[model samples]
Target chain A: MLEGISYTDTKKLTAIIKERFNLDFSNYAMSSFRHRVSVAISKFNLVSADSLIEKLLNDSYMFDLFLKEVSIYTTEMFRDPSAWKYISETVLPKLASQNEKINIWLPECTSGEDIYTIAIILKELGLTQKSNITASFISNSLMTSFSQGYEIKKMELNKSNYLRFNEKNDFSEYYSISNYKAFMNSDLLKNVSIEKFLIAPMINPTMVNLIIYRNKLIFFNSILQFDVLTMLTNSLECGGFLFIGAKENIINPEMRKHYKVISEHERIYKRISKN
Target chain B: MKNKIILIGGSAGSFSVVTQILTELPKNFRIPIVLCLHRLKHVRSGFAEALSLKSSNPVIEPYDKDRIEEGKIYIAPANYHLYIEAHKHFALSTEDSINHSRPSIDVTFVSTASVYKENVIAIILSGANNDGAYGIKRVKDLGGITIVQNPEECQVSTMPVSSIRIMKPDFILSSTEIIKYLIDINNKAFFGK
Candidate 1:
């Protein structure tokens, strides 16, 4: 029985997970992954990482639970008010004026917050009719849950953030209250194309005009971050905009040249180069 | 000793202690310092700036995956738990808050102690909660030196007192003594003594 997962055990378990689930967590930041693996072991009443690996190999259902456990879903609608404010005030309007059909990609959509926020903003701006939104998730359960609607538990924080982002509109107008739960208006997601898209090398580039891939890259190691950024860059057309989390950046010198800063504090960048 | 990293953790009533230490340290101090102090989550912009105003060296809130370097002070950013990677880079996480704190002192201390082992120098200062107690205990178990702020000198004795209850720290010093001890270590490194 181990007290916690060691760094060596982390490598062994990640390898097993890759072979079993066809998911590559080897490229994840090791410390956080190790922490999550320990949490999983304790949560399942397992004694060690080795036991966790045994259960993972034998049971497919266990993998699904584990996927949800380790994956981060820490998102609130309009969590960072400034980023949403910048999008509403500047980025969206510019894209609306320039393009006939504005293509936006929210890849590996963990929580439904980003999707709803984008949808609400698009509708408010009267750009919904002309926008194409692609929201991707890695698993079907996640998609099902997202369709259910944003949790009422987070409604307090969500409302506060919305007020900070735009005080003109009522935050409550975007969702309906039933059974003490706030179900987002269905029309908000009517135009969204939901699909399963893994975070890996891209075969078919969607070539989107704006990508709000926030706070996702920090989970990946430098090598994996570079690869994912490359895929996002390819999927994004030149002169298109990219929005990452405030603490994330284009660390690779090669990738850095492709995007120019539009808002330094908000971490919004415009794809400036084709190559 | 030259390769060691200093990790200081505190929550409530720690700002003044930290500022004093930073103000007293020489510009040529050799070891890198990592600080994990609890602060307001939504108000993200000013903590580093406030610390940098009086520090001898630059105070930085590093981006995720930024390389950790010597002689500078690195602070854990708001709303994220900070971890020090084995390769000496910073990793940030949006996982659920531990001990009701995102940049939980325990997370940074444990990660650094695990990575650096005997080379880590861990300190716990004044705080209202017992967040750093388990972390300081982990550091001691991993052969890193552990220190607690003297309870009598603390603005809030709960933090150091909690740490002392669990295990014996190597030292229990007042804020002034803590500064002197660090300066002594810095002098030894400078003179190759």
Candidate 2:
């Protein structure tokens, strides 16, 4: 009966984890899965996958940490410049035409560079004041650090990026620097709002026009990824834009039916009709 | 004499850089140092303990609604963005990540610039991405001092190089030199003897 317990037991054990944690290991590439499992094991100090499963069964905090460990929160400002450029040139302008307030969501924001970068773009384009922007993250503590705008050093680098975006005005005009610290102006960040949550709840369905969840799905088990994708698709309004990270793809098959690919290379898609 | 405030931002390779700069400062340094280093959410580590070991002054991780005091180094705790209020006190928010980094340097620097303006000293150090450039420009535009780590000396030069190319800070020095300059500036601004 339990003769091949080591190998078959591990397999059954993994299935139990998938069921209990609501994570589907099948979504991630095999290499990524291995890497994630190794990282999780080391991070949790579990001796084996069976141990991890046992730990998860008992500890909710450990289970939550496990989810965070498996998720990829890495991101950059204008990570794919062309994608941002496309939004600045196309989606933003269309929203401008309507003269209606717009809201944006950048989920799984790791450190907040991407959200602030989007705010800067909106400010440069003169849309920040008009639109109501919001970004959400998985961590409340990270959100607090981002809101403060304190960093060791990198303003000069951001200025270079602003120039690439053709922000012609003196970059210095936006901040005050003393003693190696750069303080950013509140005016530029005013309309660019921020929030924190794991998923978009149904209560706030109509508030967003664009949702940028780039590069985040690659870390999720396929089921979690699909669940998130479905949530994002449902959250968007008709003709809204959904920008995924360069490496991530929407492979639910049903996603293709609802959203049209705007830029294949940039992973930008547009909601075609109401689902 | 008004106490000078300094905010520093970095990521990727900031651990050693921050420790080096803090170690060089005096124990009785009469200023506030705020840090915004991007870190992973959850799993609290000994960042403050490590920084305090290298520096003479006390280093502490700031909590939500913490009061800002002179001569203390307040590190933004993991997973939170650090911001300064108009009253020069600390405030934390659980907003979405900006530029995909929480505890974003830009958010902290930008917010500080709004309230502190010319009174703020902003520095950019070793990092993998350009998170603080726009914030540095904002500080400079408000007539504050701006400094960046010399790209050649940075472990990860992308952040410093990008800031230099874009913002053109008043000074670009190595980590040791930056600490010296900070100490000198603080002495001048505070002691004025």
Write one digit per residue (lDDT tens) for candidate 1, span A79-173: 78888889988999999999999999998887788888999999989999899999988788998887766564578888988888888889888
**Which runs of model 1 end up more than 4 angstroms from their true locations?**
A1-4, A203-205
Writing each residue's lDDT as its tens digit, candidate 2 over A1-275 gives 00112334445655877788655555442323443555577777776677877788898787667766765544334444566788888888887787578878776676666766677778878887678767676676667767876352456556665565555567677667777787666566777666777544434655478887765664554466677777787878888889875445676777678889988756789898785
Candidate 1 C-alpha lDDT tens digits along B1-193: 6778889999889999999999999898878899999998777798899999999899999999998888889999988999988898999988888888889999998888888998888999999998888888999999998989999988988989999999899999999999888878877866575
lDDT values for all models: 0.87, 0.71
How high is the DockQ of candidate 1? Answer: 0.60
TM-score attained by chain A of model 1: 0.95
What's the CA error at residue A212 for candidate 1, in Å? 0.8
Q: What is the lDDT for B68 in model 2?
A: 86
**To one decimal place, how large is model 2's interface RMSD in Å?**
19.5
Residue B186 shift from truth in candidate 2, angstroms: 69
Give candidate 2 misplaced runs (Cα > 4 Å): A1-30, A40-69, A150-160, A167-187, A221-223, B1-193
**Residue B166 shift from truth in candidate 1, angstroms:** 1.5
